[model samples]
Target: MTMREIAFSLVAVAGLLATATAKAQAPEPFGRPGASDAKGAIELIDPKVLRVCADPNNLPFSNRAGEGFENKLAQFLAGKLGKDLAYVYYPGATGFIRNTLNAHLCDVVMGMPQGDDVVQPTNPYYRTSYAIVTRAGADLDGLKTLADPRLAQKGRHIGLVANTPPGNVLARLGLLAAVKPYPLVVDTRVDAPGADMIHDLEAGAIDVAILWGPIAGYHVKRSNGRLVETLLTQEPGARMSFRIGMGVRHSDQEWKRELNRLIAQNQREIDRMLADYGVPLIDEAGAPIAVEP
Candidate 1:
């Protein structure tokens, strides 16, 4: 069988395994500090210091020193609520939500992607699109989006992060035959596919790359505009525009309501924060979009 067939089979098996696991597990509490218990009465958390969970070193998104976008957003929320701010730093990979927020180590998670399996979201604060990055002066300039027909031509290679929306979309479209899949998180070695993609883009080895908006934008700015970024069109079953919101315990309805209010009240400031982090704001139609307070 082909690689795609193998991948499909693995996915089917994984789904069955996940369903079996869920069936074997017992039902548990879903909400956070101020949420209702089994009896359905609301429990409230005393609003004091807003405990935010975030990554310690991920740039353009979050970090420990209040330098990233989420950190700034948390500070903004604290200022609005007249509360102190504290953070619990951890790596933002697979178990971030469950280990941090669900475990009650932190009261909130800044910049959690909407629709994530764990934690509950407040009002969505911003929307971002995935992008295709290429070398400066590459022929990709005429390609406005991922659906551009020119990509099907031979002799062109695109790099994608494995298991992400972009990768899955490409695979479904039969573009994976000409694309190189990379692991952005797992293979941290210097010669890994992700690092190689970056190096090759600078070296003009590949014609294009698919990466998340914030990551691509950050690299473009860091590269002094040596790379060109084009926002991709939304594909069916692809998470093109992701809504980022603050995550609270599922039981924290009071806090969630308060956060939603804060998000609505400060939409403009939040937009500015995301822009500061180089996240491209785009609308459902794939046009340039901005957030306003």
Candidate 2:
């Protein structure tokens, strides 16, 4: 599939915190009925329905047709809670939380980076990092980190999403000059940065591409064994990794705890779903989350 079709898919599962930029740093909590108060009295969300705020078109996460991994997981969780599943559809971009969660249209966002100030996070369900994509047996195959000297010494071309943490890491490693910047704000009509990067790597247009792990993993799964993905978690101070969790309104402490309980109760199932969708999950220590046999 074209990257345009799956552009938001990888980052959504990778927990890139891209949505964190679309809204204010500190999201306002839910308010009671008939009021515009920031600290309005709590309105209890109904437990009979697991209302989710999600993108209608984003793949590998959630879609209007409920085909994505997050969609499936939401269904499972809702079933476990003895609740029906519902969605508040919106584009997964700026103003997402403002229009959906904050507007009380939905009670949960299934994939938010932990520690995100925009939403109160549940206990992290998965961890992942940026990854380097290269030819499976190429000279760069053994490449583990952006600090590898051969990258600059051999004048290899690198592709990365602009203004992302990986881009900052490359710049700090003095490899910015050889890097090709892909627009973070892409026009789906004409640009597919992540997919394009993979295509270029296959065609030898770029020697390597640094991408979010979920994105890399998804594309690599379709690469016919031609691509190699190396997670960049070994680099000290790279800050290229993050843990992802469910998002709830700040005042929904009870709701958050309930979600956390669900997470703990079904972590193995959750991990299996992530693995099925090719999310490159890692642990707090940066080790891969192994899949079941």
Collision count of model 1: 9
What ranges in model 1 sit over 4 Å off?
1-46, 147-149, 184-196, 236-239, 290-293
True-structure lDDT of candidate 1: 0.61
TM-score of 2: 0.85
Off by over 4 Å in 2: 1-21, 34-46, 186-192
RMSD of 1: 7.0
| Residue clash pairs of candidate 2 | none
Q: Please, what are the lDDT tens digits per residue for candidate 1 over residues 1-293? A: 33222222111111100000011111128544554452222433335667887666555555556776777878888899887888777654445555666666677767655554355678778766667888777778756666677788888788776655666677677788888766544311122333356777788667897766766766777788688887775676565655556666777777788889888988888877777656788765767776453
**For residue 116, what is the lDDT in candidate 2?**
63
Local accuracy by lDDT, each model:
0.61, 0.72
Write candidate 2's Cα lDDT for 1-293 as tens digits.
Answer: 22221223234322232233244435674563433222212433454678898766545566678877789889999888888888887665667788888887888888877656677888988888888999998988799888888898766799877766766667778888899877665433244567777788899889998887767887788788899888988665447677778888887887788788999998999989888877789888888889884
Error of 1 at 43 (Å): 6.5
